[model samples]
Target: MNKTFKIYAVIFIIIMVILALFEVNKKEVTDWRKNFDVNQKSPFGLFVFNKEAKDLFKNNLTKIDVAPYDYYTDKNKKPHNILILESEIDPESWNKILDEVSKGSDAMIIANRLPKNISDTIGFYGSKISYENENVLKLTDKKYQNDFIKLDKFPSGRGFSYIKPNVQILGKTVEENNEDQANFIKAPFGKGKIYVHCEPLFLTNYYLLQSGNVKYAQSVFSYLSDRETLWFVESNTKESSSLLRFILSNPALKYAWWVFLGGLVLFIFFNVKRKQRIVPIIEPLKNTSADFVKSIGNLYLQEGDFHDMMAKKAQYFLNKVRLDLLIDTQNLDEEFAKRLQLKTGKSAEMVNEAIVLIKKAQDPYASVMKEDLARINSLLDEILK
Candidate 1:
């Protein structure tokens, strides 16, 4: 019973630990996946994602993807339902659109500039104006005025107002050059309607959070709700397109492989050609015996025991000389006398005296009277010299 209980308890603890780890991993995955959703729609609202704006009118309207103004000429293909949104709209885009509309193709243009040639197609046009001051023209026509509601503030931060007219003002500009105000206007192009708004913020997620902006956005969609509207919101810049292409080209794999190869070559070159540190060869001291005798002598001199230190040094030097002269110390009396006579060419008596002094100095019991270091040094100099 005890064994079973312990096993169950251990299993339970393991399961809890595993669950905690899993929860941490799950949170990381969720955070990593939280990116900008371009297709996310507002709940109970008409604002769709910016990327999906073109498809908003697909059911009721046809979409015409107009290239830049420079690319469009009279000979270019024109669609029945045309919308123009360019970074800079030139006379060529206007001419092509106007020509298509004149040919009975429904068209709308969202641009900051109005072509001098296509003035009749524009219901309202202005270079720049303040939208906040009540200086705006109020349409007395009930039909037109009923469709629009004046906004107190424009998304552009200028004091200008927004013309929230019906869907006909889809791409039209109700305000201009006012930094604070946004404009929405609509006009008829043949049997189709053209709506234009000066501000692009209405479609963005940031501006959609504004109080009345969502309503305005929905109203814009409501205008085309009757027709198959093709909303075209372009956010692609040239730099962004190039970056996207580079990222999708699998550059990491190509560059990373080359980097690895280069690193391997560098590693091989350093490992093979680089010199290794040599172990230092320490030679033993050559004159250690001499150094030891000199150190001991200096110590005795400093202590004012010059006679004792000099006698010790003399003894060590004599022993080394005896070894070099091949003198037999076993028969010290006779052999030492003979070898001393041969090596020094001295009489036996003199050599015996010197030998006696050396032996007595080495003896611990021999009474060699202390003297000043200078006197002892002079005696050693005379004997050695």
Candidate 2:
């Protein structure tokens, strides 16, 4: 390799090495995605909640992957209190769930937002709220009114925008300047009750790890009936979907993935440049025909052969007209000038002057001057220009 190539290779290797070292020693960032998966130990995952779920339900916790419609329709399974922690349920499944709820099976849904069908059915609609500073959250009951839990800064959750008279407010989070917004509610269907809690983030591993937050979570669970707690697990597993997904979900692995891609690109670039055969520089072939013509033209100009040059120019012009205009050049008459004028879009006078010069040059005894030659050349140029 040349010195320049060697220098570039060394710089590239140094850059790659520095990047690798930096990435390897970099502090791992916290994953804050609200995956809400029981298996995920991320900040917004339900790993901690799922871990302590057995104890909370007295070892009677059961996870169901099937839809509420299919699960409820099963003849073998009896009515059990359901627990759902997801973004939203399908409308069909939700309707079936409501039917099960009406059949005296209690359910507690924890999500950021309720589906439009659910919201319309319950006669309440909620909006998302993000607090930049700490806020107070408490149950609406007289017993827990004074038990205010401090929500951390930059906490985002959902709250009711409109609540009907029948929907009983269970709990609320109050921001510094705003009124208490209902985040929890108890809506009756028939004989059973569906407790809708908007803030699923409050029950995640991050909040559960905090002091007094587990107690708050426990308090929220206190409203549920003490029966076989059926935890509804959605069929679509997001985190464990693929290896690439798992890598991207993790901060350290994501950084390593990008580093691997960078290294691969560098390796391809350097390896291809080193191993690939050098392309030979082939110069373009010189145009000798045009050069020969230019040499002959200069020789003629130096020889003072104005008559010969004029004859050659007129003959060349007539030959070009025969090939380009596809007109016969045997007769240089009035009709010929008119036809030439029409074909070349030149004035009739100009065409006639060119023909006259061409006819004069063709005569064996006619003498050609420099100005006459130049005049014919200019007339031909004007016609073909």
Candidate 3:
């Protein structure tokens, strides 16, 4: 083929390939198999019920986003029927529902497992299970002999139960061996009955939209007993739709927010560094008095003038005695030592030793040995204490 012809053929092949992929991928992108929730408008949600939702309520059903216990009040005069879709019910909520149901109210509980009280009361044991597509759930009632409620060829998740006595079995799964698995029950309490269906997801938007399944879902509602009020309860939490959250969800808006946040981070980074205080470095002060005194003491030690130094020390001790004791130091006798002992609270022997040392230190011609100097220092310490 020529170059231009070959290019044209390749372009045509690519366009055909793109068209084929679009046709095939569209179903997967729009899949609604496992989406299950009450408040959602998606395929798993009860958007199909919206048309007949308000009709079920006498006061026009306002869709509740909170739990049934939170949304319903004790004083509510309306006889409401609750549709509970949960795996388990806590004590408080379960007791409240039981109490409400006893007081002329109805509740349709849909779960694989029931609360212990309800299970005990109903006389049945239910367990969650998975089944192959070949297995089918069959419905049978005394009112109808037809097996019209045959549910198969769909995914079965978390909805399987075993049969027991006392409770009326509304439906059962048909096993491969033709043994029936009781999955739906109705039990009467005080003034009302609790209709429990193990297969809750069958009432979802995806199942209802399927061929002939809407009829089955409507048949399930027939068990509600045509109550005055309708309540849809699920475990999904409610989040109020906000414009900011909506904007943040979108890629463009989220990117813009991130860009603004990045700018704010940069501004903070630069400002933190720029606004920091410049710390001044300060040098510590050096003590010079101790050094000066040490130099003078060394000079005195270098000289052979012990008598003069000893005399100066004795004069200093006398001055300290006069200042601290308020005693006259005019005489250096035993009378002076006795007076000093009373004034200073020192022992009489210690006072006499100090006086003798002071008197010996007063002589300028006396040679002072190192032991004598040490004795004088020890005597001064005792007098000071």
Candidate 4:
């Protein structure tokens, strides 16, 4: 009975330890998960929420699904309504859409700046004014005050001043300090409307938490609720279209001669170096002086020119001594005596006599006595000392 009780106690302890380890592993798995309330009505899931916004989209709104830009460009899917949100829109992009709209393409563009080319394409029409500011207006009935929050006052460099003359102004602009200025506008183009907002923060999650932004957001969406709107929220990264890439690649075709020349130069440099061969090594022979002497000796022996050879050898030795010993060659006898006397502490008269013997032996073909050569060699030894 005691053994049974011990076995049961051990089983219970193991079960408790296993449960503790499982709990620890479970916590580790989901450590990075965050707990926050998500707003279903906002495009950005975790932004401002208001009772009016939730109710406005309760029955009428449907989330639009569309392919990527490249896919859509290839597919040529016709959208009845379009909404674009970007930090800034250049004249080129704005003009392209405007031209499409003018050709009866029903689309609405929402961007920070409505370039002049686009505004001109779409004749401006006045719309509902916002009492918040006389210049601010509502192109659509969509309003969400809770989502629009004012950020700290920072200069918004310069705002777009040129819009299409015929483009209608929908939002009213509130007069503020020149630095803190902000405005919004809308214009009709064919069957669609273009809404331009000055501040991009009005749509971001960070600014949408403001008290009145939610109402503004609701109003914007409500106005476009009637159409099959295609909301195109621009990605942080700009996408290059195939047409733009082709244009850049074939710059000569586009009359960009400079670009074509630049590409050609770069191509030449890369290809030219690749086609070249490796340089070969030509090793220099060692013992240069020995090789030179051997060649001279062979020439002298073969030509039987002992007299000229001895004369050249004597001249070579003399030149080497004068230059290496730093003695004047014009008055070599006197200069050698003085230098030898100073360098080797030898008598000047002995050094002078040695130089005289070497100078007199200029004609190597003459019967020169061996004793004279021996005497000169002895003197050379003493001078070297």
Winning model by TM-score: 2
Cα-based lDDT for every prediction: 0.48, 0.80, 0.65, 0.49
lDDT tens readout by residue for model 1, 38-146: 4333331223444455445544543333443434443655345555542345566566556655665555454444554454455553444443432222232344443
RMSD of 2: 16.0
How much does each candidate deviate from the true structure in C-alpha RMSD?
Answer: 17.9, 16.0, 17.6, 19.9
Q: Which stretches of candidate 2 lie over 4 Å from their true place?
A: 1-16, 73-76, 128-132, 235-238, 241-243, 249-253, 265-385
TM agreement with the true structure for every prediction: 0.35, 0.61, 0.52, 0.37
Worst-scoring 10-residue span by lDDT in model 3: 144-153
Residue 283 in candidate 3 has what lDDT? 81
Compare the candidates by lDDT and give the number of the best one: 2
Cα deviation in Å at residue 11, candidate 3? 33
Candidate 4 regions off by >4 Å?
Answer: 1-75, 103-106, 124-186, 198-201, 225-235, 238-293, 303-385
Q: Per-residue CA lDDT of candidate 4, range 316-341, in tens?
A: 65676677766555666555567756
Candidate 2 residue lDDT tens string, 196-311: 88877777888888877766777788888878888888643433578998899677688778867876787688768778597999999999999999999899889998888899
Better of 3 and 4 by lDDT: 3
Ranking by lDDT: 2, 3, 4, 1
Quote the positional error of residue 373 for candidate 3 in Å: 53
Instruction: Enumerate clash totals for all models, in the order shown.
Output: 29, 0, 0, 40
